[model samples]
Every structure is written in structure tokens, then in C-alpha cells.
Target: MNNTTQNKPINGNSLIEIGYPENEILGIALKINKKRTGFTKAEMLDKYAQVMSSPQDFTEDKIFKSLAEAFINGIHLPKIDEEIIPLNENPKEFKIYGIEKIEDGALNQMKIAMQLPVTVAGALMPDAHQGYGLPIGGVLATKNAIIPYGVGVDIGCRMALSIYDLPASHYFEHHDILKETLMKNTKFGAGHGFHGKYKAEHHVLDDSKFETNSFINNLKDKAWSQLGSSGGGNHFVEFGLIDFKEDDKKLNIKKGSYLALLTHSGSRGFGATIAGHYTKIAKDICKLPYNAKNLAYLDLDSEAGQEYWLAMNLAGEYASACHEIIHQKITKELGAEVLAKIENHHNFAWKEIYNNEEVIVHRKGATPASKDVMGIIPGSMTAPGFLVRGNGEENSINSASHGAGRQMSRTQAIKSLSQNKINDYLNDFGITLIGSGKDEAPMAYKDIHEVMNAQQDLVDVVATFTPKMVRMADDGSKED
Candidate 1:
């Protein structure tokens, strides 16, 4: 008898060679391997061949039924030209703050998004800029639908600030030590993470959602590897001086300049994977016009929609854990105690009641400025950032700008700016730069003061943070 067990196992490549389409390869290969675990390579190939030859005969076989059906009917993939759903003839009206500052491209995108059948209401923030589907600072509310692109790829991207008991003078005295501490404790750039003894741990890795589906399950290892690490492209960790004009009872600290730590990051590779997977699924299911395809949404009651929701929230929790670990590690290293901490995230969706009806509100790159909510809005590396409280402006969807939005694209900044220009700006502010590209030069972003001024009705400035030393992803890496 032939020893078929010695032959190589049938795999995705093998299926492709036998005329099986690319899209159906994964599902078919997985099912065959899983259901016929004990079968030899020869036996596996013979079974598949038998099913392909007489698919109708195997309709009653539980293991081969789906495969036979698939063979009978060709697999269908989404086509870009197809319009499964038509655009709304009358787009809903949306409020725009600081219209003079926003680019026409961004405004047009917001208009297109409002035309989606699922959209109920929308808003454009003062710092708005053109993004993939919705503008960067766009807030869109949909009825029983969730738009993946409206939430952006960097899910739960946010800011965190920690106030220490040390005086601002401490930064002047131990500037070198502080810089070294940041370099040693933090890992920047895409795919960069701690290894061996330095690897970070967090309870988010234990979340049951990781086991929810094959796609998410495959990402658990990546989440574990990148835990506590900050990814690049506008993301940074800095030592700063915080000045509170007045004593705040909520923070339990007196008004004065104090040493603080501020970090900007998100869920790293974990969120990117989740977004890519679900966004594709959303696009395939809810086809729209070529211009509005990115705004494709998933009905909340569907299984795919539920999976995306779970994955999105898990990313949010993971992002918070990353900030916690960063603060904990650096403070432990310096032997300092944190007196007050504040954090908030954007690029997320929320279920909120609007006009007595529930809707899914997506804030792509806007902060939730609901009444009395606290959030941080950072400027460029050389500019001062602000701490603010929300005013709950209903017309603007209770949101505020996330940052001094980029005035120039990364390519434009790199081509137009120079290292000398970046150095001069940092010198003027007495700020030290560790590792950053010209793409993130201070001049690349809009004036933070102007952005804040434009949204006076949306938020109240509570404090200001001046950067002392900053670290970002080095050159040649994309932002997260």
C-alpha cells in the first residue's frame, strides 16, 4: 500500500492550483482540514476531488454540503462599480464650526457622508481636514448603523496627562535624566515593542473577545507584543510643565506650574487590524457609489456588526491600558507619585440618545465634549497644549477638535521643511527633541490658539501644557 501520510498536506496554495478562487480558498481549506483532521494528504485530495466532480451527490453529506453548494454557485466578490445601495437624494443638513478654516475637500467629504441613507445628523469641527471617508474632525450619527471609516483606522486614538508633585524646576534640574527615562521606557515606531525581560503585560490580553472570531483571535499575539508601546506618526510622549490658572477641586491640586507627563497614542497594530478586517466586511455588505463607498455601514443587528462593535470596544480598553502602563512604568522608575490623571479618547463610536431616539455617533478625530467632560487637546511639538472642559454644544454633536489639525500633508511637510527650521522652533521654546521627522515639524500644523479660539462655544480652557522634552517615532515610519 502507498504511504500517503508522507505526502505534503493540502493547503491554500494547493486549492488555488486546482482552479478554486482566491476568496474561497481560506474557508474551504480551513473546513477541510478541521473536519478531516485524521485524513492523510492523499485522502484529503481524493475527498475534495470527489466533491468537485459530483457536487450534487454530496448534498446530503454534512461535511461536504457547503463545499458542494459553493462549487455549484460561483463565489461572488464585491465589485467597485456595483451600487447595492443608492445615495440619499436629499442629504441631511450638518453644522460646521469655523468654516473659514476648513478646506473645501473636507467640507465636500462631510456633505457626501450626510448623504448616506443611514446618516441622521452630522457636525464638522474647527480643526477639520480631509480624511478617507468623513473629514478628520467629523462627527456623524446614524440610525441602527455603524460606519467603519467614520470611526477611522486608529481606533481609540487619545491623549493622557499625569500631574506629579514635583515642581517645574525639577525638569530644569534633571532634564537629561528625564529624557533618558523616556527613551528607555518607551518604544516608538510601527511594529516596535519590548522583548524578553522588558516585555509589558496587561489585563486586556486576557479579554475573552480575542477568542470571538478567527480574525480577532489571530491578533491576540500582536496585542500582547505591542502592549504599553507607543506607535508613531504624530504620536508622542513628553515631559511638560502644566500651569493651572485656578485651583480645581476635582483634580485636588492647587493652581501652579507642576511637572507632568503627557502621552498621545492609540491601540497600535491591534486596532489597525480590527479596522481593516471590519471595514472590508462593511464595504462588501453595504455597497454604495464609488465616491461614497468608504461610508458603507453595517446594520447593528447583524452578526458582523456585533463582532465589529465588540472588537472596537476591546481596542478602546486596550488603549487605556497602554497609557496606564506607560505612566506606571515611568513613575516607578523615577520614584515619583502621580497626584492627578486625566485621559480621553477619540476615533470611536458611542450609543447616545438624540431627540428621544438612540443613534450611533461616530467621532472620527474629534473629542467628546459632552457637558463637564474633561479632555486634552495638544498642539505641535513646539506649541502649547490645552486642558479643557466641554460645553455640550448640541449643534456640534457635543464634540471638540482633537488637535491643531495638520495644515500640510506629510509629503508636503517633508519636501518644504528642513531640519534647521525644526531646530529653530524647538530652541525658541526651550524644548528638546529626541527622534522625529520633518513631517511632524511644528509648522506642519495649524496654530493651536487659533483652533481653540474658533471653538470657544464648545469648550473652556482649564490649563496649558508647555513641552520640555519630546520623543516620537524616528524617520521612515508611518503614523499609527
Candidate 2:
């Protein structure tokens, strides 16, 4: 059985990959292989090391007679290994609003998230992965205003689909040239160069109202300079089709061959500036009952809030423009026309109505799922991803999980999984990938199928694309 359960469930421990900290990580006993469930993050971290047969060494923290009771009582872990030690740790209980199921690690993250100064309501997408402030796959609804941390620094980072009319065979025809273009023409890793895809300045969108100040002036130039570039990490450009081969039957590939350029990114540094700028502003004000970390409440009538909204929308447009540039460059080489395109903005908040009342929707790693709100959910390098349309599920506040959440951390993936395995996996898929760091290996993420099923009511599947080759650019080592 897989960690992701769609039509055919696969194995979680094997096929499903993760990167948890060694010695710190807790998994079901090796002999048992599969268990119905596992322990919560707190319990695992607190007690699993002692008397536990696990990956990490156990001699770190000895659980003595004088240990805290809460840690001792919180051990409802899966019964697998040769020894079954019942614990009595009292975990900090979290109230599940809409998400009924959550993993131990995700719950721990949620515990931190709940403590964030401002919290509207959050839905833990099944594929929840740990993120900076809020967890990925986290759908948060704010009260009257919004939280920058909840929305995240990567404003409008999203996925763009470029469907080409070229056939799959044609891709192979110019494979070498394509690879060359991806290599010398594109940059990956930390310190990526734009390779001169466009002018060295980002054009300000007409729809926004931010002034032509220094920050905006600098951002505009830098954004345009990065046109057609795929920043490092999980961001990528893959060549794939929308066909599925379940059994001998094939359906809905739209005949012929199509090349899809899919990537996950944002408005670059401009968005980060906005997030940082507004975060400080909100924090400086500190008028909310919540802490500064949760600082927020953007009055539509206020200049600051309105300016941020305008800048945010402009950044979103810039991101779309970046994708368009990439799509155009890729298609120019192939000599094909774009059949259709789709995109969605994540990492930003929007004022939307639910039950006729308007509230701010802050989605960090989430996509808008408001009935026909088109978006894409990308998987790790090794998994298949989905393109979906929102169905307006009110319970979820019209949102869906972003991607397969991370099952393991970067540290763990590097230690337990090998580079050889990564090479072999890519070889089997006939895909050549570049720029994924220790954090972005395929094994580090959760099961996307499980995540999608859990939020079925939030979106309707429009199409599916299996990645072939992915190109991610490096943004240098400047903490990008």
C-alpha cells in the first residue's frame, strides 16, 4: 500500500518517502511494516527515544523516575516493535475544527500554529507539511483583517499550466536542444542567473495602485530580469501530458500530444518585501488582542491595507507574467501554440464572502477552492500531480491542500535515503531534474493521493499531468 491512497494504494514506509530527523524520528517498528496509525508528534518526540527501537539512537534523553507526567502519559503509538511501552503523557489537546485527521508531526505544527497571535480558522489539509509560520496545506480564514505570516512571505507563489499542441514524440525529436536550452539558458540552485530571458526590469501592472517608489522601482526591474527563470527548491518546469493509463483504458488526454510547463513560485523578492514591510507595520501598530507575530487587521478604508492589496495583486499579476514568459520561450523552440492556460495565487490573502458575509482568506500553502477557482496541486519529483477546479466547499472556506505535505524533514531524507535512489527513481521515469536541495528530494513529502481524497469536496479534478523532465533555477545563497 502506498502512503497516498487513490485507486491503488501503495506502501507508506517504502514507496512513500520521508525525511525525519534521525534519532529524533519515530516510526512504527520495522518488523510490523504497516500499522493502522501512529503517535502524535509531541509524544513521539518526548517518549519514543527511550526504550524505543527506532532509527535514531535512544541514549540521548533518559526517561528517569522524575520525568514529567505529561510526557509519560502521551503514548498511544502504533503497536509494532517487539516491545510495547504504554505512555501516560498529556499532549496539549487541539480542537479539530474541520480537519478530522492529522499526523503527529502535523498536529505538533498545528499546536504551534494555534499559538500564533491571530488565527481565524484553519483546515489541516491531509498532506499538511511543516512551513515557516503556518503549515503548508493550511487553509486559514481571518476575522476582519489578515495575518502576513499566515499569508506567508511568498506572496502569490503559484502554479501555471502551459498546454502545448506538440506531441510527446516531438519532444524527443528536439530533446538535446531542449536540454541545452534548459542548461545554459536556464539557471538552477542557489544563485540562479536569469540568462537574459527578458529585460532586466519588471513591468508594473496597470491594475495595481502602489506608487513608483524605491522599493517598487527596484522590484519592478528585478522581476523582469528573472523572466522565464524557475527558482530553486520545489519550483519546477515539467513536460507532461494530461492522460491517465488506469487499466487498458485511456481517457481525456485531448488526443495528440501536449507539453505542460508547471512551476511553483511567487512574486519573488517584491512579495517578500511586501510581507516584511506590512508585517512590521502591523506589529508596530500592535492594536490587536493577538500578539505581534499574529499582528493584522487591514481596514479596507485605510491607505496601508489598500496599498498592500494593490501591491499584492500586482505581484500576483507579475508572477503570471513570469509564467507567460516561460511558456512563450518554451513554445517558441517547439513551434507550437498554447491550447489553454491556468493559474492560481497562493501565499496571499483575499477578501471573499462565505454565507454572504465577507471575510479575509489567508492561504499560505493553500489555493482558492471557490467552485471553479482553477488551481494546480503539484507532487514531489516522483509523484503524479493534479489540476483541479474549486467546488466551493464552505466547510473548508473554499480551499484545498497545496501539495503532498512533507512526511520527512530535509535532515532525515538526506540521511536515510541515498542519492543513488534519487537517480534511479528519475531514470525510471525518464526525467532529468536539476536544483532540488536536501529539502526538496521526492521522499520528503507526504502522500498526495491521501491529501486529495481528504479534500474531495473542495475541488473537482480537471486534468492530471505526470512529469517527465523538470527544471528549477537556483536563486543563489541569499536566503531566497
TM-score of each: 0.84, 0.71
Q: Which parts of model 2 have CA positions greater than 4 angstroms off?
A: 1-120, 189-214, 244-257, 287-298, 474-480
Candidate 2: tens digits of C-alpha lDDT, residues 1-480:
122321121232221111111221223322122221342221222122222211122222233222222222323222243232222133233333225445565456556555443344556666665554456666666556656556765567888887676666656777776676555444433223253433433444443344534555545544554554555456677776654233211222464445666766666644655665665455444343221223344555566666667777777777677676666666677677777777877777888775576767777777788877788898777788887879987777788877776677544665688878878878988877765655567777777777787778888776677777777643211121
Backbone clashes in model 2: 32
lDDT, candidate 1, equals 0.82
**For model 1, how many clashes?**
1
TM-score of 2: 0.71
Q: Which residue segments of model 1 deviate by more than 4 Å? A: 1-83
Residue 151 CA displacement from its true place in model 1, Å: 0.9
Candidate 2 residue-wise lDDT at 218: 48
